[model samples]
Target: MTAITINFNNVVKLNVDQFYQLCRDNPDVKFERNQLGEIIIMPPTGGETGKCNASMIADFVIWNRQTKLAEVFDSSTCFKLPNGSDRSPDVSWIKLERWNVLKPEQREKFPPIAPDFVLELMSSSDSLSETQAKMQEYVNAGVKLGWLIDRKTRRVEIYRQGQPKEILEFPTSLCGEDILPGFVLDLQIIWN
Candidate 1:
């Protein structure tokens, strides 16, 4: 279940449109791009991971419905990062303004903008090093806040731009802070 990275290094890499087409061609698979132009092929999550992911997405969706300040995206939505990587966070939020500025075509395709907030739920199959690096990449691409939720360890790694990562051990809940005003994620269910 380990994700594999195929480096195109020096050889011609697929452009954004080409990558989108590649994804279209392979309807059953998930694909991602790294800043280095390497392709990351991710396998589907197992049942447990899928259920947990669904719970997390549900929380975000409910909060977004109340606030209407941002748009909520699920894992299936990929973004073209400023650093040139195409990433799909487990759950992501983009400020309404940022999303509004994109052309209709851009909106239809992968939007070329970093999310304001992102969450990475660590499935048992994901490698810690690779996932952590991906979170940092989100910060570099101008994400205001990010969370790496490790259900296995019952810990959360908080990523904020221009700051070091903060780890919370056995946190019962996490407040969205200014990034997601008035929103709070209760972690008790996931911890169990």
Candidate 2:
């Protein structure tokens, strides 16, 4: 995939509630949180987050989605990271148990929580330092697991509680590592 400049000049500004309604009406499109406001309308075409990486990321996410390991959320969210900062991950997951805690009414309003796991796929516009900072922010926010996938290096940086960020390079497997035991993400399949 190639990097394309996103044109936000025509992008519609919407309230969080209106954005939720929009997603409910059009299940095909996804949205992201606005840097200033609480919401941003999802474009009908390619969003930067989508065009940044290859389908391998999608393949891994699709596999998880099919197995119910977790759900995939693109740049269409404004989760409150630690330190009162709000940022959206490239891909994020909510544990079934935590997600189930939400009442049907609560789910109507963005689930009102942070994700259990986050995956940040590196892009041309994002620097390594920026991604690392985002990972630390997620960890500080109490996220259980986080993966910083560097497409340039084809390496994954793993973050967990009380542990150093571990880097795994190619020819190795990306596993749940007790987080979602028995689940394996074969990097070979995606990195191929």
Candidate 3:
């Protein structure tokens, strides 16, 4: 099933603490809040999507282990963006310096800082337009780089801070460039 959005703006607006509590109460559900305070209830991924997501996260983790320059996060971690939205990317990484700046308490809950890099792996239930809009939101919220990977289409949309998005068709791999030195994501596993 695709995501279902609930608009409570007209009735009640949940603060960060309330939202956190709601998430804590529902441990099995995945939810995201847009800038307008609309709660998006996302369905869990299917087996194939889960496998692909795990593979992608593993690749990032391996690269992070070697570099030690950034902190890598999986899908479960959400961030409070500067634009008043809370989002969780499929795979995200923050520079060590940026991560270190957060207080211990701040790190325990949703981080209030944007990630340096984020990757969204589209699942069967995801809406392409919605995902694209989410990627653009990440860019606007100070994300240095972002990738929206659509497995069905074998396409990758690369988002850079100040440049227009670049679309790649069936690329074998993706370079991290200056943002993540010496890191390259192998797309063969994902494409297959």
TM-score of each: 0.98, 0.64, 0.99
Q: Score each candidate by Cα lDDT.
A: 0.93, 0.64, 0.95
With candidate 2 superimposed using the best TM-score fit, by how many Å does residue 7's alpha carbon deviate from the native? 20
Better of 1 and 2 by lDDT: 1
- Give the per-residue lDDT digits (tens) of candidate 2, residues 109-155: 56566788777777655668856976886887788888887766878
Best by TM-score: 3
- Candidate 2 has an lDDT of 0.64
Candidate 1 residue lDDT tens string, 1-192: 889888876786798999999988998989999998899999889887888889989999998998899899999999999999999999999999989999999999989999999999888899999999999999999999999999899989999989999999999999999999998999986887
Instruction: Give the lDDT ranking, best first.
Output: 3, 1, 2
Q: Write the per-residue lDDT of candidate 3 for residues 1-192, one digit (tens) a residue.
A: 999999999999999999988999998999999999999998999998899999989999998999899999999998999999999999999999999999998999999999999999999999999999999999999999999999999999999999999999999999999998998999998999
In model 2, how large is the Cα lDDT of residue 77? 57
